[model samples]
Target: MSLRFSLMGPVRAWRDEEEVGLGPRQQRAVLAALLLNNGIRLSNEQLIGMVWDEPTPSALMALRTYVYKIRKTLPELHLKSMDGGYTVRAEIVDDCRGEPLEGLRSAYFDAQRVRLGDYRLKVREDCLERELDVLELQKHVAAHPLRERPRALLMRALYLEGRQGEALDHFHRARALLNEELGLEPGPELREVHARILNGDLSAPRRPEQLLPDLVDFTGRAEEIAQALRTLPGTVGITGMRGSGKTALATRIGHLVKGRFPDGQIFVRGRDVAGELLRAVGVENPVGDRAALWREKARGKRFLVVVDDVQDAATVRDLATPGSAMILTSVRRMDELPGVTWLKTAGLAEREARDFFRKVLGPARVDAEPEQAGVLLERLSRLPGPIRVIGGRLSSRPHWTIGMVLQQMEREGKLAGVIPSDCVAMLAPLIAAEERLSDPERHMLMCFARQDAEVIDSQRAADLSGADPGEIEMVLESLAGVHLIEPLVLGRYRLPRFVRFYFRLRTPALTG
Candidate 1:
């Protein structure tokens, strides 16, 4: 059987069809350093130096002890005493490879730099086969075997090779992968290369490229924006509560449309009160001749621009122009920016909410009883944020069961805050008819509108609502059935921001 050690996440060893555990920290330490220093034999001193940040007494002995344990655990490993130190045989180290093909591609590009003619020709061939940018080739290079520098080179080569589609794809992937692996992103060199390639303005001679900001995660609304993008030279707006992923969708669309535009792509934040166009391009107070720069650099550029978190109409108006496609996302809709398509986003559907809960609550815990899944979803009103919070709490409290969660919610007086009409109007339910709340429940719902507050555990709810534990539990269950208020955790609940705002006005009599 073959032997291989995996170092992608945690370090572990395995023989063909068998598992080998990495027993101790020291063993893990030794294995980690060797993986980092692949193809290089580290002397005892060198290995010790890499492992510890602080100085230690008897470092040699610690190193030897770790090596002994590793070999003992995996008798199949071929460790040799060579050139006055220890070395792992090629076959043993081979199994510990990280990203194989990515490395080969990077090396391929490095060889291209010296022989530009041959490199360009090969890049052309790649473009034909994959329709990928030469610059993108660098990304696949950086992904595994090769390092960051070569990856940047591949991005440049692809852009130079006139493979815009592939080039932009590389930048997007590199940005994501680098962020995940290193918690950072590619430098300005790549961003500028990416920008030029997308705007179809990558000059024959690569000019100076500007630095780009880190990309944000685009969840939930990817499909919505993708559909809107099909109609070019159009406008799309994302509307939701604060922190509800509006800006994320717009930014992702910007990244997506980069290839479609060849003249230029502009990214601006609505908060930039200065009204300076250069700030949108990622520069602060861009100096020298200002008017000349704006006219020469920006005029008549066919680009895709994303203006984020638009709160003020006047500010949005100043940023608008005739050319270039625009995508905007705002907490509240604005009529100032006219002649643009609008897309409204709300809470996730039942299935989406269920999937999100399963992700947070763990498949085993959620899937154990199917009936409990329906109970949890119905109680939460299928709102993603509240569901996530509740799911997260349940996941963390492994000892707590679904019944306990529900019962706790009951005793806290968190029930019956929503009437049937509240849900039908908000969620756009499948049924043509809407449900209404009973007068007693309506009175209780009015109580919530009087105070805009967070729903704590059940004990707190009982104290606030002046309702007995059993009565509160019964009301909450009834309300949840019609999607009035959503159960947060065992005694807590949350109303959507808009829902809260709506009730606030209705509660004027109580407040007055």
Candidate 2:
């Protein structure tokens, strides 16, 4: 009862390792058609079509005669008749030993031959994807350029091997070839792989697990962290003054909720955020736009996405999906985002700042000069960025005491100078924020710095800058939007201490 059949190469059958004679070529064609459509009934007309390129007047009789012979040859095959059609039960093994129905020549068998050939190719490609044999897949793709699955496999293999550029180039070539030859575009498989490559997404058909490393010495933002966590599976926006640790808080929350999102924990920043996000989830690249593709990929996925340092709400407007959660960190409040729970970050409390210093500089050093530490923290306005910079500097220079550090701060007389040369990179964010200001914004910022008052109302700003009060309010709101200045009660605003110090040092003439 153990019967095995193969149509991959010469049509053949075996019973308990013994080869069975399947009659002559024409008869074998009938048997081959029957075996290929195993468990499916084939009428007389169907059998005639498969067996003959051109059926003669006696074709039906010949088919009946072939059927009888096949039954006699392999009686165990149980070829039966029902509803005026024949059906068979056989286990067809994919033993690709030779061409299907080798030596069987009949123009009528051409379509069947082509169909079986495609099936064999699919078997080979399945093996290639599992094996990830790049070299063999290359050859396979070259032989069958229109095969999207193998090409996608090839692209993924190339990307995983760090040959991203080459993989991307291969996609472009394939796309062009697909369009040129067939007057069509690449299928979803190819486009997805291409999108992953463009977005630098290596994990496609696999969940993306990515997040920035959590700060080992991360400090403060307890209430903010709690509020962020409470939002759960919903979008949360964390905004604050520059250097208030928005990114750090978001990173911390990403780590905290890592277990909740089994699909992924993705962190994305920089200009191509949409592309990066699509790449993270392994979405296929679309032909013209990514929004639809991104939505498709994000839908019904349990994942966490941390979009850091977002400058504009529009950039990530469509990033949220139904089943996933997202955290966005920005310098200013993004009220434009719908249903977003906002958490505004501020400078760490005195205790948290001390703890941060202890973690960075060691308790021994911090405890040694409590007074100097407090003064230094006061000078830095308890902002995490400056504290981290000064702590890192002091940690390395064990010989320098907190008093000496404070003296250095006084001597330098500017936020930029307080940071050591090697640690000057920490100030890049602050500098970049200032540099992004428009000409009028920058001039208005200088005007704000010129006034002796700590907090300036629109009227005061108008009086100082000689601009209209309405225009000054717009400019002040714009400045507040970027976190360069903090809006206070009663339509007043105060420049952050660090911003004031930075502008004072850079443009001393304006302050004078």
Best by lDDT: 2
Residue-level lDDT tens digits of model 1 in 309-338: 665766555444434566777655665577
Q: Candidate 2 at residue 321, lDDT?
A: 81
Candidate RMSDs in Å, in order, are 22.4, 20.6
Q: What's model 2's lDDT at 263?
A: 67
- C-alpha RMSD of candidate 2: 20.6
Worst 10 residues of 2 by lDDT: 414-423
Q: List lDDT for all candidates, in order.
A: 0.55, 0.78
Error of 2 at 124 (Å): 31
- lDDT for position 237 in model 2: 90
